[model samples]
Target: MKRIIPFILALLLLAACGAEPVEAEASPPPPMPTASPLPDYIPPMDFEPVSVWQAEHFSGRALLYLGAEEDGVTPFKVYSCFMYEVTDYLDGNMLMGARAFCAEAADSGDFSVDCSNRGLWLEPVLGASALTGKLSVDGDRLTLEYTGCELAAWAEDTPGFEYRLSGGQPVIDSGTGENDSVQYLPTEFKRLPDEYLGRAMYWMPMFEEEASASAESVRGLRVGDTYADIVARFPNPLDIWSRDPRSVSAPDGWYDTFYGSEAGTVFAALFYEGGVPSTVLITCCSYASFQLDGGLNITQLSVSAR
Candidate 1:
C-alpha cells in the first residue's frame, strides 16, 4: 500500500541485528531503543568488490563523491535517480545503481567500472542486468552517461521482483516508468579522500530491481527452512519481530513478520505457516507494482536451507 520507508532502507536500519552470531554465540538481547541511526559494521564481502564506495557527503543534490584508496576498498559514489527507485536490479535489470564490480582501462587512461554486487543484505541480489552502466573516468572527471532499461519480460521466475495478477493477467499501468527530468540523466562525481564506510554511513550503499523470487533471509535463513532452524539461528527474541499479517500479501496459516526488528525495517518479512518458512516478502526490490497475467505470490523461492 503506502510506502513507510524507501525499499531496502529497512536493511540499512537493521544493519546490526541481522549480523548477530547464531545461537551458540548469541548474546542476551539488549535494551530495545525507540530510535537509532545507521550502524558501523562491515562484514567480509562474499564476492569481490571492483570499486567499493559509500557516499561520504550526500549533497542532497546531483553531485557524486568518490572515496580515497585504503584497506583494499574505494568508495565510488554514483548517482541514483533521486525521484524513483531502480527496477529489477536483481532480476537482471540494472541501472546506474548497480555496484561497480568490473574494471576496464585503455591506453588513454580512461577507466570504466562494472558494478555487480551491492552492500548489506542486498549482496545476494546480483545478476547480469541491462542497466549496468559504467563510470567512464576520462582523466579526473567521472560520469555515468548510460540511459537504458530493459523491457519488463514479465517472466514467471524472477527472484528479486513481484507482480500482482488480476484475472490471471497483469494489470498494466500504461506509461513510461522513466524519469525524464535532467537530474535523473547522466551525472558527474567529485572524488574525495576519506574513509567513511564505518563512520558516515552504516554499510555499503546499494540499490536493486523488480523481478521476483525472494532473495532476502534473516541470518542467511532461506525458504524451506524449519521453524526450529529459525529459532536456533536467531535465539534472541528481538532478532525477528512477528507482526500482523495483511490479506493482500499473505498465505494461509502463516503469520507475518520481518527479519530485522528495529524501527526502520519493513523491507524483508518472513511468513511461517506453523512449520518451515512458507513464504518470504521482499518489499524492497521494485518500484510500482506490476500486474501479471498469471498468478504470482509473495516471493516463494527454493533457496538452500543449508
Candidate 2:
C-alpha cells in the first residue's frame, strides 16, 4: 500500500510541471483628438485700370493718357498725359529723332508744352492736342481710334496733306483718309505712379482762382521768415518738435523743427542752414506739402494724399 501511494504522488507532480503559464492582456492606445478648422480671410480691393492712349511723339512716341480708378467709396478719376513731336519714322514701327513735346493732364486742361526750338522741324508739325478717341484694351493691346475731323487733326498733320472736307466738316473714310488707328504694345505703355494719381485728385478743385489765391498764402507764413517770425505769426501753436541734424548725419548747422496747430491738423516744418531759416514746409489736408527754400522761398511743392 505505501509503494502504490509514492508512485501516485510522482505521477501528479509530473502532470503539474508540464502545464503552460498564463499572460496578461495588452491595453489599446488612447483615441487621437480631432483638429479644429481655421476661419476664412478676405483680401483688400484692387485698383482698376481705366483708359490708356498711345500716339506718335517727337522723341519717339508717348502714351498720351493713362487713367486708373482710385480705391474708395467715392469714385475719383486720375490720368496723366505725355505729348511728343515725331521727327522721323524708322523700321519696326519706331519713331526716330522724337522730342518731348509736352506734359499735360488728359482730363484737366492744364498742360505744359515745350515750344523751344520750334523753327527746327516744321514739316510734320505736332502740337499739344487733347486726346480724342474711344479708348479700349483687348488682351494686351491698347487701341485709340481717331474719328471725325477733331480726332484726325489731333492724330497727325503733314506739311501739305489736304483734308477731304464735306459740309464744312472733314470727311473720314474707312481704311483711308481722316480715320486713323493707334495701337500701343505692352512695352510701349506704363502705369502712372500712385503719387501722381493722388496729386491729381488733390488739385482737382484748384481750378478756382479763389482756391489758388488761398494756397498762395501759407497761413501768413512767408519764405525768408525766421523761427521767431513764424512763432510770432501763430500765437497759440499746437505742438513743436525738433529733429537733430547730427543724429541723421546731416551737416546742416541747426536742428530742424516742425510746428503744428492746436487741433493737430495744420503742420509746418522749418529747415535751417547756418542758423538762418532756409526752408519752410507747410502741410494741410487739402493741399500737398508746400515748401519754401532760399530763406523761405517757395521752391518745392508736392500735393498728394499719400
Candidate 3:
C-alpha cells in the first residue's frame, strides 16, 4: 500500500509541472562580427573601427569617473550608460538620443579606448555632470584625456549645439531589431501631429512671456536696440544663454528662435535670467535678435500698428 501511495504522489508532481513546447525549437543567436586591425598614426584619426571591437564585450553602464587626476587613471562605477542615439531628420536641431561611447584593444597587444560616435556608447559621468574631455574605457576604469583642442566636426560647422556631424562617418550598426540601429524613440514621433512632424524643425512650446517677475531693468535697454548695443549691455546674452543651466536649447543654437517667427519680421533671441525672458530687442541687422529669457532683453516684440 505504501509503495502505491508514493507512486501516486510522483504522478501528481509531474502533472503540476508545465509542459514544454516540443514542437517548436528555439534558434541560437548569431555571433557578433569582428573588426579589422588598425594602422599607424593617421592625420585625421578615425575611431569607428575600434569602437566596434569595444561594444562586443562592454558590460558596464552609467560609468562614473574621478575628477581631474594628475595620474591618467580615473575611477568608475557600473550603471549602464549606453545613452545617446542619433536620429536623422531633414533640417535644424534634432533631438538628443546621442551615441554611446565604447572601448577596445589594438593588434600586437596594444590597447586603446575611444568615444563611440554611434551605437551603444558608454557614457562617462563625473558626479552629476557629463565629462567633455576626450573619453575612453579600459576594464573597470574610464579614462578622460584632455589635450586642449577643439576639432570642428568634419570642417562643416557642427550641425548645432551638442550635435556632431554624423555625415561622412562610418556605419557601425544597422540599428534594427534588438541589435539593429534605428531612430530615437519613435513613440514621440508617432504622437506628434503630421504638420509638426513634416517641418524639418519648429519652435517647441517654451513659455508665454509672463507679465511680471522681472523686478528691475537696465537703463537704455529697449526695442529697436542694435544687436551690438544689447551685447554691450549684457556682455553677450547669447553666450550667457548657452552656458546657463536653467536655459533650454533653441533649434538654432544660442538664441531661441530663428530669423522670423510669430512676432512678424522681428526675431527672438532668448536669454533667461531666473527663468524670466529679458525684455530688450536687438535690431539694425537683417534679423531681429532679442532676449526671450531673463531680466534685461525684452520679450515683447510686436505692438498694434498705429
Candidate 4:
C-alpha cells in the first residue's frame, strides 16, 4: 500500500515602509511656525448655576463641585453633584470643574443634607466621621475643615476624575476613604423593559381549533369567512374611544358572557394582525391583568386567565 505524505508548509512575510537615508547635503527647512494664542482666551464664567447642593461627609466626587457648611452646628448632608464631559478643560489642569452644596442637621445622626439632587435625607457617615463642618469651592479645589481636621479636593472640569483626599500625611481616597486611591466615574440610570407593566409577555397562536371556532362565531359580522371575519367578532358598541388617555370606566354588560355579572364588566384591549383577531389584554384590577394569547389558529373552547 502506498502511503501519501501530504506536504504542509507555512510562510511568514514581513513588510517595512521607510525612507532611504540620503548622503546629499541640503538646507533644513525653516522651523515650523508655532500657533499664536487665541485673542479671546478668557471665556467669561457664566456661573448661572443650573444646579445647587448642600451635603456632608461627602466622599465621592463627580462632574459637579461638592461641599458642606463651615458652621459646627449641624451634622452632615449631601446635596447635588454636577455631570459633564472631562475632555473640555485644560490638559492635566484643574481649571474646569463642577460644584455642589451641603448642610447640617442634629436630629438625624451627625450627617444630613438638603440639596437639589437627593432632596432631604441623612447621609451614611455620622458624628465624628461626618468629615467636615461645611464645604465650599475655592478655584479648582473644594475647601473645608471639620472636627479639627482640614482637607482639600482637586477635581478637573471633566466628568469623572479620581479625587484624592487633601491635607494630612497618611493620605486617603475621597469617596472610598481607603488609603488606596479611589476613582469616580460618570454614569446614568437605566429604564424598565416594559412601560407600566410589571412583567414581560409574548403572544402566539393557540390550539388550531380555537382559531377556527372564533372564525366561525364571527362569520356573520360583515367580514369575509376568513381571518378578517375573526376580527369583526369584537365590535366597538358604545364607541367610548374618545375618553381621556388616563382613566377609563368599563361599560356595563361587557364581560357578562365570559366572566358573568359578578366579574364587573370592564373594557379590554383587543389586538389584531392583518385585520384578524390575534390577542386580548384584560385588566382585572389596577395591578392584576391577563393576556389572552391566541390568534386565528386557536381551537379548544377554553380561557386560561393568569
In lDDT terms, which candidate is top? 1
- 10 residues in a row with least lDDT, candidate 4: 196-205
Compare candidates 1 and 2 on TM-score and give the better one. Answer: 1
Residue 53 lDDT (model 2): 36
The all-Cα superposition gives candidate 2 an RMSD in Å to the true structure of 27.5
Which of the predicted structures, 2 or 3, would earn the higher TM-score when compared with the native? Answer: 2
Q: What lDDT does the true structure give each of the candidates? A: 0.32, 0.31, 0.27, 0.25
Candidate 2's residue-wise lDDT over 1-306, tens digit each?
A: 999999999999998899786676866323221222221211111223243333332112343334352231211121211111222332222211212222222332222333333332211112213222233445545433323232234234543433332232222222211111111111123444434432222211111111223433433333333334333333223334222221243346553434332122134455556554455444333333434333333455444431
- After TM-score superposition, what is the CA distance of residue 300 in candidate 3 from its true location, in Å? 31
What ranking of all candidate models by lDDT puts the best one first? 1, 2, 3, 4
lDDT of 2 at 41: 14
Winner on TM-score between 1 and 4 is 1
Tens digits of per-residue lDDT for model 4, 28-91: 4333223222121111122222222222234322222122323544322222222112222322
Q: Name the better of 2 and 4 by lDDT.
A: 2
Which runs in model 1 stand beyond 4 Å of their true positions? Answer: 1-81, 85-141, 145-175, 178-186, 199-282, 286-306
lDDT of 3 by residue, 48-94 (tens): 11111111122111222122222443322111212223344322322
Model 1 weakest lDDT span, ten residues long: 287-296
